[model samples]
Target: MHHALAFLALSQLKGFGPARLNLLLQQCEPDGDDFYADCLRYLPQIPGLNAQQVQLCCQRIHNPFHGEWKERDQLLHWLAYDQHQVLTLGHADYPELLQQIADPPLMLYLAGNAELLHQPQLAIVGSRKPTIEGFNDARRFAGALSELGWCITSGLAEGIDAAAHQGCLQANGKTLAVLGTGIDRVYPRSNQPLYEQIYYQGLLISEFPLGTAPRGHNFPKRNRIVAGLSVGVLVVEAALKSGSLISARLACESGREVFAIPGSIHQAQYKGCHQLIKQGAKLTETIQDIHEELAHWLQLPESYSSSSFGLTTDSSHFSSNGLLSAKDSLPAVGAFSTAKNQQAVASNQSLELFTGHSHSADPSSSNMASTPDAYNPNLTAVAIKQKAPSVPKFDNPQQEQLWQAIAQGAGNLDALVMATGFNTGEISQNLLMLELSGRVVQEAGIYRVNLSV
Candidate 1:
């Protein structure tokens, strides 16, 4: 308790950030015969201890331990609760991965299963205002990954982060929520249920001290911890200027794998992911892609090692570029296979060629002659049924206007924004609705009216 008090005092001292405190601790090794007194005695000798820092340390050492009794008592009371504890930097239980970062927190206030801190974690993050499809993708990926025994780590924000947590929990898997605010307080207030779920089932971790409010700046600093604790980060959907990208960059800098799901190039939500893929981040379409990339770190069970979720481990399916080979013919299944075929074709072609009608078979082609559709009535029916659905009516004037603009050759987000006189956010929301409703199609950065309409 005494040592904790001294450490707490050092943490509160101005100008004593993690780097400086680490340096001071290395020099003095504040232990034995009244550690605080020893720190006061050798404060001046510490290499980076400026005069102001030295004076601050002296003042803290001179003050009685109970001087800030209320705050100290509060922390003690919090720690007294079951499963609530603090991990200092040098402690054996401290996560080694977090310590490897450039600026590790001096202490972490943890709630729930502390053992999870040692488990391999994969961070999933993205936009707070994700499209419905983006939300579903995050949930599906997180749930699948969790079932494979990897712990999911994320901030407890709304949208993608919340969906990730919910998915992991639904799979009865462990997850961790790294907070920008103090563990005692849940920001956004709306996440109270999620906070409770994580607190009871997984873990809640934060570097911020008790009662720290949710300040804007703290989140970016909090992002480093999210990336640091994970073996890799999966970005579902993030705009160009989002915190998810920051986490991805931090993960890259710390030598962790970065994975991004490619989205429609016309959506601003996917711009950051596109940028990441262009910069060499792994392009992940399915859980297999993630599992393959993190195979060495994941240490899968015998079942998973041989195959994943019943999908055959056909190395031939993947191309030299590490994507699914487009040339491989789709297996004859039912509607599921038809959907998979579309995805496979999308994967193989450039974004510009992903428009559903781009690869129509030519009557003069040799393959058309070899496999006559007239010989297989069932296959012909399936092919005809798999054709793109007709466009639906718009829900409102905004959506109608956006669709009309695209139909009028407003081919990009900026052009649509200009043509419809809608701001980026409004345009994005309407476009997403149109895309989801099959009224519009976007490939590469170009928007096209669904000709099937």
Candidate 2:
């Protein structure tokens, strides 16, 4: 208890982030019956610490109990609950992967299953304002990956992060939610139910002191922990400037695999993913793609086999140079043909844990609500029965006419608009929908039929 208090005191010191704290600890080597006495004696002589840092350390050591004991008290109160723990750096239960990061949290406040800290984790992150398709993809991927015995980790933010957590839980799999605020606080109050579920069934982790409110800057700092705790980080969808992209960059810097899902070229939401792919991040289409990359790190169950999931190990999806092929075909059209079908697949594929939900920033009926009947398990299989589109089909005569015009000689958007007599918006929307549905491909402002579709 005394040692814990001393460590807590050091953690409370101003301006002493993990990196500087670690360096100071190494230099001072504070030890003995009176740890504060040792700190006061040795901290001043530490070579790398600036004068202000040394002064802060001196002040902390001189009056260790000066400030509020609220943080320590709250930690103790929380610890009295079942399965709650505090994992300090170098502790036996501290995760080795996190410890390897450049600036690992000095301590983590953990609730629920502590053993899960040692389990393999894959981080899933993306835009807080994800598209409906992006939300479903996150849930589906998380569910499938969790079934393989991998724990899913994410910041307890909305959108893709929430979907990933719920998906894992639906599979009766473990998950971890790292927080930007205190462990006791759940940001975006809408996720209160999810917060409780994870606290009891999986784990809730935070580096923030008890009662810390959610701050904008804390999330980027929080992103590092999300990446640090996992073997890899999977970005489902994100804009060019997003916290998800920050996590991906941090994952790469830490020597962890970074995976991204491609989205329609027309959507600004997908630009970050395209950028990541261009920067050498792996482009993942299916759970099998991720499984192939992390197979060595995973411990499969006795019943687990490649054949169980009908996963193909062939690398044809990727180029000979190991990157995703530039000419790689888009996802099958059946995956995104209708909103109903997308909802069915998202719900049934992941067992309805996060069915028909959207956490977009601008929440509205159009973006957040889905058909109430879409949760039927058989509906997903039925919806996918349609043969993959070999030749793109359009229900609207205008879209069909526009597509035919493009297929013939009118390849550019302007030419298509002129040939079909449709307005520019109509042509652009049709082209985008076709590209998203895997029937059309756009290159250099020219549209072409996807022959491989």
Candidate 3:
């Protein structure tokens, strides 16, 4: 059996967590192959194992196929899919930054691009109901950073998380959605379209085992992976008790940089960002603030430099062009592939990541939708794409004026106010009407025409 499969079996033993599994692997030193028999032989000699513990270990090692992993077959079935993969702790392809965490997961289930796990990631997290301004900020920052070769990572929740992912997609950039549920499941059901988009265009990650559901406790656990996978975390908009705050704290604990966008003192949504700023997170207003801070890390040794993140050195990171290639830093293509598997595609294009599944048949074709109803969770993927959406006719000249302003790229609410010579209330009312009719969408207080019509 493959070592990963053997580790999966060993991982199923009761009482065998990541720490215990690490200890067992260290003692057995199973590099010679037949890890199960080797672990069985070493179980008796390893210290810290009582007689009963040793006996149980031996039983598990002797008959790993009969171990307690109820989902072993399910895992095998998932792996049979081209893009579905499991990276064990000792797997050569496991993310290096994730290994630095205090309690790393034994394995990570990956969908979409497994190679993206090696890319430089910046986590954007915030409240599920952030103000429109906050939503735009997350989207703008995500898009900007993606252009700089950063893979935007998020929990895939609503509000700020959705904006960050959408912005990255819009920019034709790389993104990773770390799920709180199993890799197979999409929670909130409302994000089904977003989930499908990432499944085809970006990466979906989870440390949870197969068949896991979205439980309250699972989100905090998921936040750690979001932080661990990133070089930094940015809290776009969050409440004091927000899960985004938890991700920021975890990033700090993991030695990753944390950035927070400051908001008004009176606003309830900005309180957590203020708290994070007070806790030494950088006060960020623009992407330049983030670039300056992370540039310091580029000065570190090769082991800690941006090259280690599988990101090439651009003009932003280096004074000269092409100082380093992303391919130079990452493992060769097909490192984790089997004989039947085709070679993984390179991440040379702005949007293309590794191609592990049949979805790679044409990676350049984008699936972005331009309307609010495009993400109607009730609609299937084919329905969303093939359905002839009705365009709402506008009888109000003011609403048409506002829509035209947004379509022309003057998306900021204040900008729209200036361009249309309308008061704040008038612009707000017309924009709301446009949004309601699916003619426009707003984020971070910026309104844009929705092309679905």
Candidate 4:
């Protein structure tokens, strides 16, 4: 790595942040040997990136931050810290668009194939609680864009974000996943598989350092990176109250094209897209529109010619390793399943986990209501809140008794399970079955009886 890359890597540490480090690094020669020696004099002028933090970073180095011993040691240790790579703004590997942004990340932590960064890319963003159709749209658009040589970029979130990555991968395209957490952590835990896939195929990037976990504030920070990496962005589906719209607006501020796919007049998800269309977002329906809009930069025919490429839809989806395997073994496309029922699951931890029901909530039903019939419909994120867990089954007498205890609120599930004196296997199986039957509800990590008759 170059000196700038090393300096930037050290700067990614806990206290040696980009903005402050940039200001500090400028005080010394960009290629000077005395850079570390000059550090102590400049330490007094820096703010936000405290001296102690610098001391911590320098300590690992032999010389340390020149009398800011701790700073030097920490910087040294930071310099030694591996696993992540740092790309400077002027580096050939740095994305030119990102460097031009209002606040480009001085040091980028990239964990995938660097070549993906070279491809022209489009941003695809939408609600974390997108509908199945919304997910399908994101995937299809991303896949199509990928085929057009556009790398896909998005926040590594659930719903629309994952859908976009999955789509690009299905088309055997490149992608980039920016996260709100450290490269080591995957938020929502359920997205682990998707995260792994993207890390292996596309690129995983973050402005945050190696150990940062998700904070509510970290996400908005991440959104900027998504907008910065792409030439334009498309909003597939989002509600008026969604963050994807925030990203789309950011893309606009960055001088990138903003496009939205219109939805039904009656859908809440459509509102954000419609609002953007009115705000001058290009209304897009097909990949051709995006390719056409970006023609000068993306380069291509005004319209796709059969000679440019024929649309070939086969079972050529990629498996875990980022390669298209045999046609017969591909898993079903994310679009085949409707999110209408997906809301019925969440956390992947819930024995009765329901993201939302397969059907939308009655909206007319009270919080404590139960299904008049054993079968209630699916739910929607309508992302942060989770539905009550499902009661999987009540077929056995011992299991039924434990279920009764859980529903009646005799105690929490753990306590009831203990009191009812049931084995964990039987208990979990019964609970999951009850959830699937819609007879029980789990929420706030607690299980309750659906009381409304």
Query: What tens digits encode model 1's per-residue C-alpha lDDT throughout 106-188?
Result: 88999999999999899999998777567656765776577666899999887788868866775567899999999999976
TM-score of each: 0.68, 0.67, 0.67, 0.60
lDDT of the candidates, in the order given: 0.71, 0.70, 0.69, 0.62
Q: Report the candidate with higher lDDT, 1 versus 2.
A: 1
TM-score: the better of candidates 1 and 3: 1
* Alpha-carbon RMSD to native, per candidate: 11.3, 13.8, 12.3, 14.1
lDDT of 3 by residue, 1-453 (tens): 366666665555556666776677776654555666777776576555467756765664566567565566788888898788878776678889998887788778899988888888899999887765676567666765675567899998877888788778766688999999999999877577778888888999988878888899999989999999999999988888999989998899999999999988999999999999998999975555676677553333333333222343344532222122222323333343442122122222221211111123123433332335443321221233344444357959998877666544354544465568899788878777788887887643335566566
For residues 215-242, write the lDDT of model 4, one tens digit per residue: 9998988898999889999998889978
- Scored by Cα lDDT, where does model 3 land? 0.69
Worst lDDT run of 10 residues, candidate 4, spans 346-355
The true-versus-predicted C-alpha distance at residue 445 of model 2, in Å, is: 43
Off by over 4 Å in 3: 30-34, 42-69, 296-392, 395-453
The true-structure Cα RMSD of candidate 4 reads 14.1
lDDT of 3 at 109: 85
- Deviation of model 2 at 64, angstroms: 7.1
> Using alpha carbons, what is the TM-score of model 4?
0.60
1 or 4, greater by lDDT: 1
Q: lDDT per residue, candidate 2, 1-453, as tens digits?
A: 545556666677666677667766764543445556766776666555577767754664576566655766777787788887777775666899999999989778898898888999999999876765676577667876776668999997877888688667766678999999988898978577788889888999998887889999999999999999999999999999988999999999999999999989999989999999999999987676787889768764453445333344557744453333322222333434364334333323332222222222221213432333222221121122221224456767877786666544354443465567789788888888888886767532335555455
Worst 10 residues of 3 by lDDT: 349-358
Cα misplacement distance, residue 243 of candidate 3 (Å):
1.6
* Best by the TM-score measure: 1
